[model samples]
Target: MSLHSLDVRQTALTLLRSGVRNAEVARKLNVPAGTIGYWKHMDRAKRGECPGRGSHDCPRCDGVPLDHAAYAYLLGLYLGDGHISHYSGHRTLTLMITLDDHWPGIQDEAEAALRSVFPTRGTCRVRVKGAHNIKVYSKHLPCLFPQHGPGRKHERLIALAPWQQEIVDEHPWSFVRGLIHSDGCRITNWTVRKGKRYEYPRYWFTNVSDDIRALFTDTLDRLGVAWTNCTRYGKPYNVSIARKESVALMDAHVGPKY
Candidate 1:
C-alpha cells in the first residue's frame, strides 16, 4: 500500500477503536465514509486487537510515566473520592472526580491535575450534577490507575504499588493535598470561653478505609505536620490538624481546596 493509504488506514482504525462513528471519522480525515467502514470491516476480519485497548500492548496507552507530584496528586484523588472505570463494550477509560459545586477553583485544579498527567490525550470535561464533577477520557487509565479493581477501595486492600510509593515518598505534600482536597476540608472554627469568642482555622480529613487514613496520617508525619486522629460515634475515622503551626504548614503546601 502507498504511504498515504497506510496513514489513512491507521487513522481510520484509531478513530473507530475510540468509538467514533464512521461518518465522523471520514469527515475528520477527509476520507470517504465507506472507506472507514471498509477498513474497520477488514480489521475485524483479521481479529486484531485495538491499538490502545489491550493489556500492556501500546506504549502510547501505557499510562504516562509517573511524575512525582502529578501522580502523587492523582493517586490521592483516586483514593479519596475519585472513580475509574471501563464501561462494558467501550474502549475508553474514564476517570472522574466529583467536587462540591460551591467550591471555587476546584474544577480548575482538577483539570490542571489531569492535564499534568495526560498532557496530550483525553480532554477533561466538566459536568454539574448536584456538584461539579470533572471527567477525563483516555485509554491509558488502567495503567495510570492500577489501584482500580473489584469492590470499594475500603473493602479492598488499597496499598500503593512500588512505583506509587516512590512518588509519594518524594512528594508527600502533593499527595496530601489531593487527598485533603477530595476527602478532607479546611475550615474556620469558632468557640466561646468566659464571655469571649475566638476563631481558629483547622484542617480535617475523614475516610472509612483504615489504610487510606493511615496513608494520610503517615504523609502528614513525614512532613512534620501535627495532626490528631479520632473516630466519631458511628462515623468514619477523622484526622484533624488544628495546631496553628501545622495549619500554617498545610496552608503553605496544600492550601484550601481550590
Candidate 2:
C-alpha cells in the first residue's frame, strides 16, 4: 500500500505527463526523487508507455553507435537466460535476466553490460528466492533483442539478425563468455590412476534449445575450440569442451565464473 495520498500521486503523474522532470515533480510534491521516479515508472508501465519512448537514443531506431562487444556479450546472456515481456498494451517492455545469488561477480558483469548497452535507461534488481532478476524497462528492447517473441525461447526458433551475427563474429569470445556465465560452467574432475591423481578441467554449456546449443557450438568452432555433445540424464542438451586445447582456450577467455 502507498503512504502517499491518491490525489498527490495523481498530481505528480499529471505533472510528469505534462513534461515536468522527475526531480521537479518531486520538489513540487515534496516526495522523494526516488519515489517520484518509481511512481513515474509504474505510471508509465500502467499506461503502457515507455519512459523514454520516442527518444533519439535507440541504437536500431536512431542509428546510435552500439557498443559491439558489450552488446555481443549481452546478447549471449540474453539467449542463455534472459527474457523480455510486454506490460499493459505492449508499448512498454521489460528485459529481465535471472542470475544465481552464488555468483555476485557475474551479476555485476551482467549489470555492467546492461548499462553499457542502454546507458540512459534505469536498471533495477529484484530479489527472488536464491536468485536476482536484473530488470530494465524500455520501449526498444524488442529492437535490440528481436529473438523475443511469444512462447518459450526453446519452443520458438532462435536466430540472430545479420547485424547481431556480425557483432558476434567480431567478438566471439565475449559472446561465449556471456553464454558460459549464464547457462554454462567450468568444472574440474579428478581421477586416480596408479596411486596418482589427475584433475581435468572442462566447460559445459547446457540449454534446452537446439538452436541455442548449435549457436554456441558454431561459435566455438569458429574460435577453434573443440566441443562435443554430452547426454546427461537421458538428454543430449549439454555441450562439453574437455579437450585440453579447448579447455585451455576457455580458461584463457571465459574461465570459471567468480
User: Which candidate leads in TM-score?
Assistant: 2
Clashing pairs in 1: none
Model 1: what TM-score? 0.73
lDDT of 1: 0.76
The digit string of per-residue lDDT tens for model 2 on 1-258 reads 237999999999999999999899988888989788767766654443444445788888777778999999999999998998866544467999999999999999999999999998989999999999998887677778878777898998899989889999999999999999999999997899999999999899999999999999999999999999999899999999999988999999999998
lDDT of candidate 2? 0.88
Per-residue accuracy of model 1 over 67-95 as CA lDDT, tens digit each: 56877887898789788765655545678
Model 1 residue 97 CA deviation (Å) reads 1.2
Off by over 4 Å in 2: 1-53, 88-91, 194-196
Candidate 1 — worst ten consecutive residues by lDDT sum? 45-54
User: What does the lDDT read for residue 252 in candidate 1?
Assistant: 91
Alpha-carbon shift of residue 177 in model 2 (angstroms): 0.4
